[model samples]
Target: MTDQRQDAIPDAIPGAVPHTRGVRFAVYSAHAKAIDLCLFDGENETRLPLNRTATDLFALHVAGLKPGARYGFRAQGVYDPDRGLWFDPSKLLVDPYARELDRPFRHDARLSTFGVDTASLVPKAIVTEDRPVAPAAPRLPKGGLIYEVAVRPFTLLHPKVPAALRGTVAALAHPAVIAHLKRIGVDAVELLPITAWIDERHLPPLGLSNGWGYNPVAMMALDPRLVPGGMAELAATVATLHENGIGVILDLVFNHSGESDRHGATLSMRGLDNLTYYRHVPGAPGLLVNDTGTGNTLACDHPVVRRLILDTLRHFVRQAGIDGFRFDLGTILGRSPQGFSRESETLRAILSDPLLADRVMIAEPWDIGPGGYQLGQFPPPFLEWNDRARDDIRLYWRGDGWKTGRLAHALAGSSEIFSAHGLGETRSVNFLAAHDGFTLMDLVSYSHKHNEANGEDNRDGHNDNHSWNNGVEGETRDPAIRDSRRRDVQALLGTLFATRGTLMLTAGDEGGRSQQGNNNAYAQDNALTWLDWTTLDDDLVTHTARLARLRRRFDVFSESAFFTGQDGDVLWLNEQGKPMTTADWEQPDRQQLTMLLKTRDREEDRATRLAVVFNRSHDALAVHLPGGPWQDLFTKDHVFSPVLPPRTVIWLRELADPSARDKEAGES
Candidate 1:
């Protein structure tokens, strides 16, 4: 890792003119017979003939043009979706890697909604615009809490925030939002996507706008609409987050772009280099392989495509001060021309890169391609969103049978899955809810998805949610049922913080954020998705903050590296403190489990040990505690004897000065 000094300095801010020379552009036009370039010089425009290569990449060498300079590309061709050719020279095409968009696209009078029409409502391009870029912030990974959130709704309707700043990247810096995050005790905010994106032409017809920014257009640049301040505004937010001791972990979608199948949009790499950018249409001349389930998957195997991906990341880290990234459908990044290979150049390059090693790198670890699930396959210094961890944890606490062993491995960091990589507990980015599906609240509120509000007739999101609502399907007025459900939430949070892995939490899950049983709230931008910051139930918010505080108390929970202990740092036991039996592993009504976790590598000061007891049932149950002086992490009630509770979780920690519990609370 480079010194935390001058060498770690980020790239020059975007608004400031980069002293380096000429303009750099990447243009795409799939069916253009000829292409032209235009530069905006106030009202008057300059034109130039782009030099064409065999791959159809048009390049123009120009003087006096640099970053923040406004420019666009014009392609001439027959525009048609049925014939699968869309090229309109009159429409201006924005560079896919534009550092900043000229302006946000309005759905009103002048817009580009053309799939493949010569004359279209939507243009396959954007105009020239520049937003100021701010100075970069220092990236920090130490004990950082990862809060994954969708960009639009997180701040869109936040009552305390200004309307203009809502739904934009610049809003991230807004005092109200940042103050909330700081108060919540998160170290980093994992934004879903901030890149330029396109809502599917088909989705708009359904009266629903896509909320999740999964379909990407530009890779390296910030979406102009995301920031009313543009690139300059986005940069300033990074500085603000850093100043506040929070890091930014972006959820990047390298697996695919907004360009759907061959007959879809033509704004980016698909236009500039089709056969090289996207997987070719199978047995068809101009079709595109839709491995991403969206429309087209990027060709990660191509040498040039690989370079673009790598450069995009480096540019962001060097310039954007991006503390880390969680790659969407990341398994695709490791596939080669022959097939999926862990040794693929893309993986090797990222792992070995000098510039990127120190930054956090997380992966979604799956794709739609054959044999595309590579959950435990990413290299070291990397973390993965452990689906096994998510499912097993949910199953264990939901009172599912024969799950003790499954639960053990999950809480112990799924060593069997990631052990081959010499990874210890921290590599598993454990979570129960993410942006793709159900929120934690709905995880217990509904057994099946209720996505009718998404206008997909409840067919849009995942079905097998592994959620148990304590004997009810939705909200309940019965205090016993409601309290029991809240207890399950408490248990899950306790288990997550007590486990021996670094954690990545979905944004609103801690405070019981729900989509009203709609697991997929990706298309609803209203209150259905926006966090009700105004009325977050006090009990849920208290539990979430307590979980955050508890994680900090344990070294294993907060550290970024794997546990290097000789014996297992985490051990599982039954009520008898014996090994789990076959019967205990399979009984559906039995969801109680116990764990002991060593908090450090034995080299750190203020050593601590944790014992966690859990029960996922409605009836009150007693659980045995290890014979040690234990202070309840949440309540600080000292327990020197066996301790148990009904449908509850109790966290016990070994503190150096247990008697002065009041002193610790005051300092905190």
Candidate 2:
């Protein structure tokens, strides 16, 4: 504990003295005639009575308050529940917008945010002042590929990552990890929830924790367990990633928390002001609303909760240079009192906020409530995780046809689903695999999900995985069958890069990472999920790099917005460059889909094109070129394969030098 002047809003950034020195501090406490900014100075309370004009703004401008000073507010007001005004002068309340906190509020009886002795069955407040300043981590977004990762097991046993840095945010900035990401061409790293959270009681006893990070307790603070030197080390990591042109994004969980159902204890929100933060049943005074498959859902419709969400977001952006945020179960953010509204205030605030306006705000897009599947309905400037694209691509490649039309729309950025909302191709965050379901290898090797490792008796995880086993269930002794499976996995990776949208590949998908058959590896935190860096499979590594390199070379394949018109930027054609017929799209066993992605070639000042032929059937198919001299980028040859074998994806790029390949062929 140290003594500090208590006059202004403290700064959270290092080196720079608080610009808010001598600035006023205020919070809306309408009932409190007198409010005190209880500054925790040197183990003593340096209390300052706030000078107020109106009841709405409880404010004060006194001296000696600097950065790192732990403080809370005490207000005097009527203790009531039905009318929604509960203020206890003896209780200490944290500022809803505080940039930093000493320690997270312990879920003890003493620190209830709600009033303990209400006239009725009202809530109570947890009166505890913060201590020590917790530094804030820098935020990230921009010019990066965000790889969402679970924090705890990311580097728990990596030989390169220091034992001290393991399992923490600072660990991500370790030299070895950073080098790996750079080597793989990853631009951004998105961490799953780092906010303080409580484990689900049911999971805690079984050695399973909330690995997905769907539960959150502290919104503005970093999880101490994942921070070595605490927020300061986390903050340093941000600066480091930014120096390397990489960005960071958090998997925010504002939908629900560990506190669930009507029987949960009164913690932060339930103890402070239950009605203000959580959605409740209409007539039941104590029955809380649940929608996130969790016990309760934070009501984004409420004024306080809305303000809390906005303040927390703005605080992170200001204190840290974070480039973006990825919202888990984000559909709940669009819900209103009437129902889930696309034009809800929560959504409106995110768009209008100057600090977050240009940030990479991505939504999980679906929940467990009614009309919860708000896939393509998110407003503009938002990226949605396109589960439809994931499933369709998997199904098509497995030879489940009569689906070519829908696959085309997805490959072209799902204009059918998002164009009406004024969004383009980049709005869809396309991926063939994510952490929630099966890995790319598992999707091709196992038709059924093997989630017994999750300890839920295989009852958990999605049943309709849109997968194929390639003639065998587990391992196969047949060489031909094994080769086919490996090729299909490569085809899926190629399609992910060739698709017109923001591509999100799971960490190990590029190298054919597998979990044996476990679709849900959330709890497996072992060799099953950790990337195997030891395997030196040169061909597989080269193939994955080739896919990423192709995406980097051709803008049309990775363009933010898909081009319209037959000759614009992309084209869907049959074998002979003609319109695809219903029979062609519906042919179940016919397994070739040809798509041409065109881009503006700067050197020649003309549009360059790349034709990708995806052959998925067991038999070979002859694909005709779209009436042009195409160069095979790999071999620098003009010889196009008229007949390509099954489970293969061939890419041919139009070259600027007409004689580039001819000269090479002559030399050969």
**Cα lDDT for residue 397, model 1?**
72
**TM match of model 2 to true structure:** 0.81
lDDT of 1 by residue, 333-422 (tens): 888646787788888888788777777888888887788888888877678889988998887777656457777777767788887756
Give the runs in model 1 whose Cα sits over 4 Å from its true position.
1-33, 40-46, 53-57, 63-69, 76-91, 105-143, 421-426, 559-568, 578-591, 600-608, 640-643, 654-668
In terms of lDDT, model 2 sits at: 0.67
Best by lDDT: 1
Minimal lDDT window, size 10, model 2: 118-127
Q: Residues 222-320, candidate 2, lDDT per residue (tens digit)?
A: 655665354566567877887786777777888986556554433334433555567777776456677787788898877667877887776566555
Error of 2 at 468 (Å): 2.5
lDDT of 1: 0.68
Can you give the lDDT of residue 384 in candidate 1? 85
